[model samples]
Structures are given as C-alpha cells and as structure tokens.
Target: MPYKARVYVTLRASVLDPAGTAVQKAIQEQMNVEIQSVRIGKFIEIFLDSPDQTKAHQTIQQICEQFLANPVIEDFCFELDEIPRVSNLASQG
Candidate 1:
C-alpha cells in the first residue's frame, strides 16, 4: 500500500520570524486589526510506497530531519494516510 504524508515545517519558538512579523504589521495598519503574533511555515506533501506503517513513519522522520526541515531552528511534524488505489474500471462511466 502507498501512503501520503503531509509535512509542516515551522520556526522554533526561540527563533524569530521576520516575515510573519511583517505580515502582522501590515494587517494591523491596513485592516485596523491588531494581531499579537503570526508565524509562517511550509507545507510539503509526499507519497510513498510501503506496506509497513512503522517503516514508512521512520523513513518520513529521517527525511524530515535530514532534508525537509532544519533541526536547529525549525520544528517539523507530519501526518500520514493510506491512499486507496482505484482501478481504471472504477473511473469509467
């Protein structure tokens, strides 16, 4: 079975996000809505073919730590779901 993963990468709380701050400032000035805080992050989607759930999770974790997100300043998490394989006959009307 194949699994789909959604990964989110965000700056750690200890790190400062200048882009988020700028967006917040702009919103306050233009819309008159004061936001205490804002944070920007990245979303990534990946599909993998693996029958074992544990192996899939471990692989994704390694990928996140090694390539997807920086471990030092960024924090990452992911959610996985099994995609049901549909046959061509099912799509034919």
Candidate 2:
C-alpha cells in the first residue's frame, strides 16, 4: 500500500527565528503596527509504499531524523494516511 506523510518542522521555542523576526520588524516598520511575536516553520509531504502502517511510520520517522529536520534546534511532528486502493472491478460494478 502507498502511504502519504506530512512532516512539520519548527524551531525550538528557546531558539530565535531571525527570519521571522526580520519579517515581523519589516511589517511593523512599513505597516506601522506592533506585533507581539512571529514564528516560522516548514511542512513537507512524502509518499511511499509500505506493507503496513507501522513500517510506514518508522520509515518516515527515520527520514525525519536523518535529514528532514535538525534535532538540535528544531522539533518535528508527522502524520500518515494510507492510500485507498482502487479496483477496476469496482468501477465496472
């Protein structure tokens, strides 16, 4: 079966997001508004074939640990969905 996974990567709360801060500053300066805070994150979608849901989750977790996210300063969350198999016979019926 084919599974779809979504990964969310975000900077740790203790870490400062320079890019987000810069954007917030720009907005404040240009738009004349005061902003409390800003946070930036990334979302990734992956599709893979697996025999079972557990294996699919393990694969995605490994991918995230190895390359998708930086464990030192970032945190990640993932969700997986199994693809529904379509049958030609069902269509005919």
Candidate 3:
C-alpha cells in the first residue's frame, strides 16, 4: 500500500529567525502596528509504499531526522495518509 506523508519543519521557539524578524520589522514600520514576533518554516510532502503503517511512519521519521528537518534549531511534525486503492473495473464500468 501507498501512503502520503506531510512534514512540517519550523524554527524552534528559542531560535532567532532573521528573515521573519526583518519582515515583521518592515510591516511594523510601514503599518505602525506593534508586532510581537514572527517565525518561518518549511513544508514537504512525499509518497511511499509500505506494507505496514508502523514501518511507513518509521521510514518517514528517519527521513526527517536525516535530511528533511534540522534537529538542532528546528522542530518538525508529520502526518500520514493511507492511499486508497484504485480499481480499473470501477473506472471502466
């Protein structure tokens, strides 16, 4: 079976995001609104085939830990969706 996975990577709360802070500063300067803070992140989605949900999840987590997300200054979350089987007969009929 195939599964769809979504990974969300974001800067840790304690980390300083220079880009986000600059954007917020620009907005505050132009709009004259007091902005507390701003943060930026990345989102990634992938599809994979696996026989078991547990294995799929583990694989996705490994991907995140190894390449998708930076563990030192960032945090991540993931969601998995099971792919529904498609039937050729249903399409033909």
Summed over model 1, clashes come to: 0
Better-scoring candidate (TM-score), 2 or 3: 3
lDDT, candidate 3, 1-93, per-residue tens? 999999999999999899999999999999999999889899999999999899999999999999988899999999999999999999999
Question: Higher TM-score: candidate 1 or 2?
Answer: 1
Q: Per-residue alpha-carbon lDDT of model 1 for 1-93, expressed as tens digits? A: 899999999999999999999999999999998699999999999999987888999999999999989989999999988888898998895
- Where model 3 places Cα greater than 4 Å from the true spot, the runs are 30-34
Clashing pairs in 1: none
For all candidates in order, the CA lDDT equals 0.94, 0.96, 0.95
Per-residue lDDT of model 2, residues 11-87, tens digit only: 99999999999999999999999999989999999999999999999999999999989999999999999999999
Sorted by TM-score (best first), the order is: 1, 3, 2
Distance from true location, Cα of 8 in model 3, Å: 0.7
Error of 3 at 67 (Å): 0.7
Model 2 residue 44 CA deviation in Å:
0.7
* lDDT assessment of candidate 1: 0.94
Off by over 4 Å in 2: 32-34, 89-93
